[model samples]
Target: MTATRTSSLRIAVAQLNPVVGDIAGNLAKARAARKEAAGQGADLVLFTELFIAGYPPEDLILKPAFVKACEEAVDALVADTADGGPAIAIGTPLKRSSGLHNGLVVADAGERLAERFKIDLPNYGEFDEKRVFQAGPEIQGPVGVRGVRIGFPICEDIWGDLGICETLAESGAEILLVPNGSPYYRGKVDIRQQVVVRQVVESGLPILYANQLGGQDELVFDGASFALQADRSLAFQAPQFEEGLFLTVWERNGEEWRCVEAPVGAIPQAEEADYSACMLGLRDYVDKNGFRDVVLGLSGGIDSAICAALAVDALGADRVRTLMMPYRYTSKDSLRDAEDCARALGIRHDTVAIAEPVEGFTEALSRLFAGTETGVTEENLQSRARGTILMAVSNKFGSMVVTTGNKSEMSVGYATLYGDMNGGFNPIKDLYKMQVYALSRWRNAHLPKGALGPLGEVIPRNIIDKAPSAELRPDQTDQDSLPPYPVLDDILECLVEGEMGVDEIVARGHDRELVHRIEHLLYIAEYKRRQAAPGVKITRKNFGRDRRYPITNRFRDRS
Candidate 1:
């Protein structure tokens, strides 16, 4: 019989972080994962979608040399299987006579068993696979690996209406193994489980889902890989926002297979998941880019304080630093608070007086200003001076600047570009002002599993209690210029995430005039958000690829 039967089979899930464009490094990671699986005596090791090419290769997939390099890496791995240890099921970009395809290859020993392409090329939001990849065949059969026939679907294949999973089941595939590069947003784990459960119920087969782990630019792939039985029961679940290697043992029960041995645990909460995504995103951005350390302005405000804490948690305290660029308007409370927060986190804190720089700029511009009254122009000079100082520090010490603006501020142009907005990355860029405060409280109450920072209140109580301020002028608070953060965040969410009209937002008990004004601000601030540093996306709609708006867009809801 051509079909194989097995009472038991073992498979390993390789949940790892891969840097885009790092072909050789990714190959090494694959090799190490395969070795680990072999040590565990597994039948096959499964990697995430586009593992060799490092997922979402974007325009890099358009390059022939890059695709060829990834193909060569897969060949090398196949050669390694010549010893007949365990099979390798990996994702890579495969070039065909028709076009390039997001391909998955299954190999055992020295022989290639199967090759399948993603039937659905996701072309919306964060995915643009259709821009580079061609769809797979209408019907795909399973490959027999160690007496078990497993059907593999790349990311987005099962999520669509292609009926690929059901097709595989009809083709006699006993189970499904899905490779995904799915990124994180709030409550994404539950969504994934629901999607997989539907597929399982439809196909009458179990599924093993392996998602990529780590930060790729603005996207953070939380590795909460897991398996589900045909009965809609969770077989096992991997941790989120982490790199893990998990082995699963499956046993044939009559006509179906079930995961007999694996991990089963609860995933992290939304708050923990958001915080972890930010930390992981910042860490990968800094390390993958080869930065020695990170530095951020600690203004004694909740935004900067939380960003500083996230930095310490991501990279140890010794690698993180903070600076306070104080001017005349800078209050003594801010001074003390910045110092206190730094001490609490045990990071380097320095003071750079921006008075002189501001004075010099004022002197140079006085003649040009002539009779112009001192106003926002002068206020912005203070911010610009501090920004210059931060960049200088970054240049001299080789530290990446951490921008500390929250989404609430970014939405309404509350942040100053090239000033407080100056940084290589922002950990909380996707978080709103209210969300930032919530995470601050959450961080103080809990030390994450692998956090490098100390336990207890990393952010001082005074910092969280005090009103937020940029201190560009005397007695300044965020509320003086814009609506309350709770009000602002809600309005922005309705506009940005919910895509609600002004009348719809006003119906949410907001002042009609205020909603219109905030809507206008959100549209006008597009230019600043366009230039903002890339940050981890925890929300469904981030400022970057997730939400694209024209900087010069003119449409606004006048109602």
Candidate 2:
């Protein structure tokens, strides 16, 4: 007679986006997700790591009372799960006899089923996990769930080649479930899929991976949670760059478990993902912090135009406003393009000509400077005037000002500090200049997430086609100061992100002198980046708290 398998489990992955330090609010979101999963006949609801307290609580996990409160919240959640429909596997930091362990508390019917701690602690890049929490020793046996043994690995444990999954498989574990609070940068989604598929193949057990989705300060989490079969095929995918919940069905085979077919949600492209990440981060930062709307200077350049479209998409037309601060050097095409982009987004727009203030500033500085040649100093004055006008509008109308400088500009001190950089938040500071142009074209062609403005050509095609300029001086195109965007972005990636030396960059067939100039500018601009507004990070080495190069360091390696 053939052996038969009878048991099946329905698991719901809650791709929840939680705010830092908001325990009560996070708990509320978790409970609501659990309830929804239960209503859909799910046996278990799996949430991302530290769902109770939020991911990478950093030093907050070192506070004893905060950890205790999180444990209490976990207990309360366990009690809430006793409603008899669905069990919950949730991550939280726990204070134990040994030390503080990054852990997950599993509950079924008001009783604790298992407590799994994270074994591997990542200590590089944006993570300082090894600093605060103690690593878990090792699991002796698999967690028993519904008469079937299951393995539960916390976030970083399943990332590597060796660890819990192999041990659990050797000890009769039938399935694996992993939870994560992974932050978003470019190329992270592919890395996540590779790791999950590796675990499934290694353990010969189907895997369920859940991840958090939201913006917390400098970091943004993209929710592209997925499930994989024992054969390493993708079973289902949750939505990316949003909060969602979906159920995945798993059935028992001879001794292993396998997943059934489920609909995979839409997967956005690189440009779309970057755009949505910015919009989501901006929307959350503004709305969660209690700002009702945003205001910004609408230059005809691609950066501000794309930023305006993002603002309108994130907060709707009523919540976004634009002011064009035209100086004597401002061009007619610029005026037309700014108005066209704002009008296309259905946002309130007005021109506040700064000719008087420009004249006044020039007069004031003329007496002070006396004999200094009129150069970048005078050009920056115009930018400062526009910044002042935008800030004044923000102060009067209670709207936050959104700065619109891209990463390329921010990298090379090309942006004037306290001038065009004045704002409460920046939407595209992490995006490169070429990326800004691409996203501008993409937005003109497609409707962005939660877009409330008119559909077609919100950003005029001319804006996309125009030569990029600051218009601070007569005929001052970006190319006059920096190299073309494609070349500049490549050199910047090599220097800033790759940490490539001068020779390595020169090896890429770039002009050696130009590369050196970019490097100097990047290092010199550290001071300005320190003062810029917080924006979503879409690259490996964003110029925020993530990359910390000193402004006064003199250790240039020219060899």
Candidate 3:
């Protein structure tokens, strides 16, 4: 391949959301994006990895029919380019004589120009690509389009030590274009920038990174797509958690290709980004799963309140239904707070008393528990009753139940198994208790721009001001059984995310006994975590896909 000196080139980055297995819908999106890019005078348009089949299509590629459907979708898009529109470099899975491969196909003017397979297939930590996709045989050279030689590396190809970028550069590639389905974790944007900068510095060529934007099950792609010049300077940046077609201009200066400066969209960080990720994840899950409405028990506690707010923000107030399941242990203040929150959010609020069901269960189990004392088992009855009621409503109304257990509670097994933990999905499963409080405060301070809820404080101040409790028994609070949220969250973070030993955690100003107890709880709770509903992953190591542990393990980190 020889590098051709082209004067100018315009590339449109389609950072759009795609639904898994929705081949026809995804094809329509691709066609519309190409038409828009053509109108903007773009020379080419780049889409994220596996846009047709959606990212992490998981086991769907194994089905011959599914793979055939994806190929048909790609063919349809290729046929649409006969009108002399901008060329397309889109991601799709291809079935070849060798094996199935995660591939990128370039199409222009009713002709397929080049097909490049992903060189690296990631298999660890939320990715199982190696199980499905076969790695490309060898490093291929760049493809020339309109006098410019461009290299296409699918997601994970450039993240390894395979020297894909270096190989392309050595083959006279002028620019590197990477299509990614990179999921959003905390501070992932910085990590991506660093990765791209390293590749650019090594290849001495401008790199454009286009990432998918949407929530696919437990994964949320932030789509903070950006371009880096060879000098490590940013050329353009698309906003995170948004779906759009952004145009970037490139011009040849002397012998090098450089991206022209364009509008750089503002990107949120820290809590704002985490909140946005949760919103997008929930919204996409609800929308993509074809649920018309969602139901959650708003207990006037911080976790449930914040989840309700998120539900309304993701799916508008009209689509959310809050049920307050009050029992003998439920306080007057909680009922009032729940009502206030529902009123502020403009959602329907109803009260379903659990006393009858609780008593009914107690009566049924009285003979079996003749000698047993009424203790934790009885308290769990209240929870199970509430869970059953919520499930009944979900079944009757055809709405999904949203569980509301935070990371701290989940880490220590503080949540009941089939009781408070019974739901289809959880919006805040990855958030720690402290993070939940902070997000609630931040939400009260300012409504996110795309939030569907009202402008004022949707989560009442009293809810944030009150003590955190499950309210399963008389005067019971969360601290009655566990440590303070701040201390517990810090210790769990060290244990779960940091993977620090007991001594190391205690050295960080925590008591030795407390650290050991928390560590024990964290380890024992793996069974429960394994059974919990899937939620958005906002941190580096969430319970579900990011961190995997054996439920029957006996080894403990005594050190």
Candidate 4:
């Protein structure tokens, strides 16, 4: 990195949203961003990890044709550099003699300037790159473009203890550029910054971190891209859960690169971040998967009401549809609350009574169980009837069904299988019952940026204040089958995320017998969770990705 007094670099960071397996679409997006960057007189443009093929292509990466398509797309983009515009640096999958690898290539003016492979492959949690792609063999040196030496580190390279960033700096790299597909969980932005800060201190070089924004399956990436000066000062921040092409100017000041111009984008945090994540996840899941709209059974309960609000905020009122599947047990208060919420959000609302279906099923089975008493099975029929009605609406109109079960109920098998759990996707699957109420209140008081839903109490006050229930039976409440939500949520947090023993959980003021019961339920519910629909992950350990438990095991937290 030869330094001069008058050298300045104009870099454009593309915080984009890419659909997995859409090589042609991703390439078109890259070309468009490059064109816009050229208009801004950018010397170079940087994109997030696997930008050409989208992030975490999962088992799709194993296909030979898929890998070839990704490589072809990268080559096409590299050839586009011959247009005499800004240089391009993007991530894609590369097949080599060593094996397939997550690779980054830099191009300038019709020439492939530099190529690098990911040094570390993450295997834990939702990442299973090691199962398919080969880890990078060695740490290569930086590439020189426009007389500046820039190093590339793909996602999980700098996060691990491989020292790839430090090695690049030692090899005369002046700037560090890291592209990532980091997903959203609570407090993830802070954790990412701390990781980069440590790397910056060790490498003694400025870093420009570019992360993509989009939802793939259950995971949603928050693109709060940021940069830091060599002196450890924040250069700029891109807004979270947003897509933008931002430019930053860096000058060679004596020996080190320093940022001169950049936009500091607003960063969403905590509950707002979580709410926006669910909304974005729903929007992308519905749009990318080719769904025209979404429908969910709104029972005037907190969970269904909040899901309705999030669906409206994501896809607008015109695209969101709500249904109230009523039975004999359905209360008038619930009827009023659900209607009020739909009215406030200005969405299409409809009602479908399930009494005939419930009665028909009962009569068909009455001969086989003439002496059987009415209990949980009979109540579950109500739920199943409701589920079937919502799915029918979806099938008839091509709209996806959004299930509204929270994490607390899902933890203890509180949901009925093929009943309330039947849906194309879930919006609040990771949020606890308490957190669901909190977000409901937050949405009423504050309308998040870019939300299509109306502001000022889109969710009614009565909905937030009401006790949650399934209404499968007369005077039925969630607490009748399980503990209070506040107590259950705390116990669940300890057992699921903390992996705490029953004895330890009991010590936190919970009853010893109750802790034991909740633990057993959590383990037994693994089967139901296995079949549950995917949703946005808000906690440290969501059901499907972050935490994977065995369904046939008998090992218990007997402690």
Candidate 5:
């Protein structure tokens, strides 16, 4: 009997963030990734979905020049691969006879092998794929690589009860490789795991999943690339909140391919993951757009404190400045806490007491409002005063003002427009108030990536443990204007992201009146959110740009 030897294939997955419409730049990234894979003696290099043109180009993909430029870049990349190391598989848009397809083209050296188009175009919740892409009938077979058959499925193909994997398996594909440009949202990783496991169970083949990571305007992609073996075990894992590239080996055992288990790295906790994503998104937005520093008003509240810590961590201590704009109602404790936090972080701090401006504004408005007593009008005036000071500093010093309203406040009409709401960027606008506290504690416990300030206690402990207040009026507390954060955050999670109606949320054991009030507030805040600045998103549904609701609509939660 002659001894038989089976060949093994090593595939490298590149987790990268590419700028949209940057054709030449994306091609250079692909070339560099291929070179890295080749250096490791891997047989093939794989990139995320739409790697050539970047994901979700929206209307830009409809342009003829942009698509033509992408095609030319692909051609140049093919020419360069002639001297090659590893074969390449990358995603791009394909303009066909029927329509434009979100497609992937595979190549060996300089020759094109096979092309596959995504069959499922998701149009729900932050995805508008159906608006731009024409789906292709599933390609069942595999492309030959190193004399082996590998299956390809564009994102959304393996997501559900789709038979793409089964079809490929029946067509004699030994392994499945999925390329995705999935966006970030809370609990999305679990969703990915469930979908990938379904494909693995169906095809009985090991699968490699790669995803893009970065902030594209209002969206952020969390790169937690993973691999699953036929036995439903997670074989290899990549870190979240950053770009990475790694190789995994698959071995053949009898009929199916099995992933040789690589060490699984620890994934960040929910709070930590959310914090890092916010910091990275804000950092990139500032750096890429040529803003060097950030300035924010610190109210000794959870929102501004967390934003300050994140800004310092993202852009260094020298680039961050905190201003304590105290008024007559401003608590002494708040001033002391703000000073402590600034001193702890080693960032620039100043006290520009707003009492002078507050008095002047009240004196000016007294005659016009002679008949009316004070209410939210007076509260809003104080906020406007602080907003003016922050805006002036932003103008004169050229520092971007970082707003610090969390998602809870943003969802309701709790935030004052043209007041505390004015800023160039907000790091925590997507997080709930409860989440803000959790992340603040997490940062205090562990050092965040790219942190340049001192390691211990950046946020004052008193601030984290104290009640949140705007201090716009005497003895003001957030609880006075809205429900407690514990109840408010839960209601928001259901009403906004879950899309649950009043009765449905009430079924969750909350007071019906409170639920009704929250629903009304959420609906009314659409107008304010429309004018709000973009923020880092950590949830499935964030206000502004991503979730568009009508301000004049009369939909009510009758239940």
Candidate 6:
């Protein structure tokens, strides 16, 4: 159907967070957002993709009851539009006669205006939409809202080579309103902007990109919703790592439509964005999963110190608890640093000596290891003791344990399997060792807005400046086993994110033998990473869903 040309349109982008499988809660949020948009004199309110059912519902869409609930929720919202204050466009799963599909329902004037299914289903990286959703067969037409023709292309439809936006534009779509459930990774904002700009340039129509916010499982969507004019100019921009209902006023000048009243929100960059993404991811994961509190073992090192600070920032200091499980090799500096960090953050701190348990485990295993040397296995006992102590505290206090292994350790198997890897979540799983140190320094320098911790430095300076150590043995440092963080992180970034070959990495001023060894360690650590707890993903590739490698694979980059 062709939509009549309008002189002006005010669209509200509801970039809100929704919980997966909570249809009732999601519907309530949608209703509230619609009401707020109506109050702001918006002609239409646009929600992110799958806002009713939540983004990346994963296998939850396979359950008949869940899909029914989502449909019912959409029905309620459709019925609520009878007031005619503002039209509603929401994402949900529609069970058609053909199959189940990811769909958008456009409702206006007490009736269903149109339904558009997603044409392209992404199945790469962390997305598995094709596994559960059937792609729409053909391109859908634009929906008319207050005399404006607005195209509704779901997330992946515009990201792929489907030409959905071009087809819609050819069919008289005046403005593109794309809803996305896009997750956050480092430098994703720029990529999304470029994608929207390309679509706008191709269609010669303004595009409004709305993305979901909050964390689900390992994915965290940074809601940096924005609008782009046909001239490839960013007309409006919403803040990242926040949830809100933003409004933009558009007016047609002659034959072209432009956003007349654009509100450009501040967009964070680099480490700031990465830190906020991690904090939001951890906060949403803990809050949505109904965790009362979180506990972690602070080893007076950079990793644990920053993790403790992050937990306190994500969940208030009242909700964070720190424990120092010092062993025989634990130095006084570690104890002092841990105490200083806890005091700085104003969180509860305790000390639990692991000497008893370490000695007990050593004695118990001495008989079996009569002929073996006391080296790595013995060192792991200390970590296992600390892990057990943290779990015990968590169980006794009904708090979840937060693991504190950065991406560098996880990449090279520098962590113990059942020890440091044991936790409900890790905030820095996607960040390398150097990134961890950088974030620690950033946290100390500036207190990010919306942080629940104190304004001053929460991570002790000593923790940031001192050498990192697991304290499993006497005078041990991370560099003793693994390469320096600067070198290791560069090599890892090349191998993981850059996907560079060993020779290519060696050409970048790295030793060929060292590159090969690091490659081997990275490959061998896959099994340990597979068993590690879920963490925030701040990079283009993370260990869990972003990078998948078989444990039994024998192929190596020998070239």
Could you give the C-alpha RMSD of every candidate to the true structure, in order shown? 1.0, 2.6, 1.4, 1.3, 2.9, 1.2
TM-score of each: 0.99, 0.96, 0.98, 0.98, 0.94, 0.98
Q: In candidate 1, what are the lDDT values of residues 1-559, reduced to their tens digit?
A: 1255779889999999999999999999999999999999998999999999997799999999999999999999888988878899999999988578999989987777888888899887788888888887565788888878889988798898888899899998998999999999999999999999999989999999999999989999999999999999999899887797899999988987989999886789978989999999999999999998998888888999999999999999999998999888888998998999999999999998988999999999889999998899899999888888889989999999999999999999998888889999999999999999899999999998779999998888988888888899999998899999899999999999999998888888999989988988898999999899999999999998888888888897874
Candidate 5 lDDT (Cα, 0 to 1): 0.85
lDDT of 5 by residue, 1-559 (tens): 0124346778898899888877888898998888888888877888999888988798988888887888788777767667767788889988878678898888876877778888888887778888888888556588887777889988888985668898999898888899998888777888999999989888888889998988777778888899999898899898887686788888888887887845467777787778888888888778756787999998877788889999988889899999999888889999899888888888899989888887898899889999998898988888999999999999998899999898999899898999999999888989998889999998888887656656878888999988888887778788987988999999989988888878888888899988888888888888998888889878888886567899997787875
lDDT of each: 0.91, 0.86, 0.91, 0.91, 0.85, 0.90
lDDT of 2 by residue, 1-559 (tens): 0123347888899998887778889899989999899889998898899989988799999888898889888899999977897888999998887679999888887889888888888877778899999988766457776666778887788886556798899898888888998888877888998988788777888888888998887788988998888888888888888788888888877776778756587778788888888888888889878898999888887888988999988889999999888887889999998988887888888989998987899998788899789888888888888888888888898999999999999999888887899999898988889898888888888886766666788888888888888888888788998899999999999988899999989999999989988988888889999999999888887886578888897676577
- How much RMSD separates candidate 3 from the native structure? 1.4
True lDDT of residue 515, candidate 3: 89
Worst 10 residues of 2 by lDDT: 1-10
Global lDDT of model 2: 0.86
Worst 10 residues of 6 by lDDT: 1-10
Model 1 CA deviation exceeding 4 Å by range: none
TM-score of 6: 0.98
Q: Report lDDT (Cα) of residue 503, candidate 4.
A: 85
TM-score of candidate 3 versus the correct structure, residues matched by position: 0.98
**Shift of residue 443 alpha carbon in model 2, Å:** 1.1
Model 6, 1-559: lDDT tens per residue? 2356679999999999999988999999999999999999998999999999998899999999999999999998989988868899999999998689999999987889999999898989998888999998789888888788889999888887878899999998889999999999988999998888788877899999999999988889999999998898889999999899999999998878999896898899888888998899899989999999999998899998989989988999999999898877889999999999999999999888888999999899889999997799999989988888888888898899999999999999999988988999999998998898889889888887678988878888888888888888899988899888899999999999889988889889999889989999999989999999999988888987989989988878996
Candidate 6: residue 77 lDDT (0-100): 91
For model 6, which pairs clash?
A: none
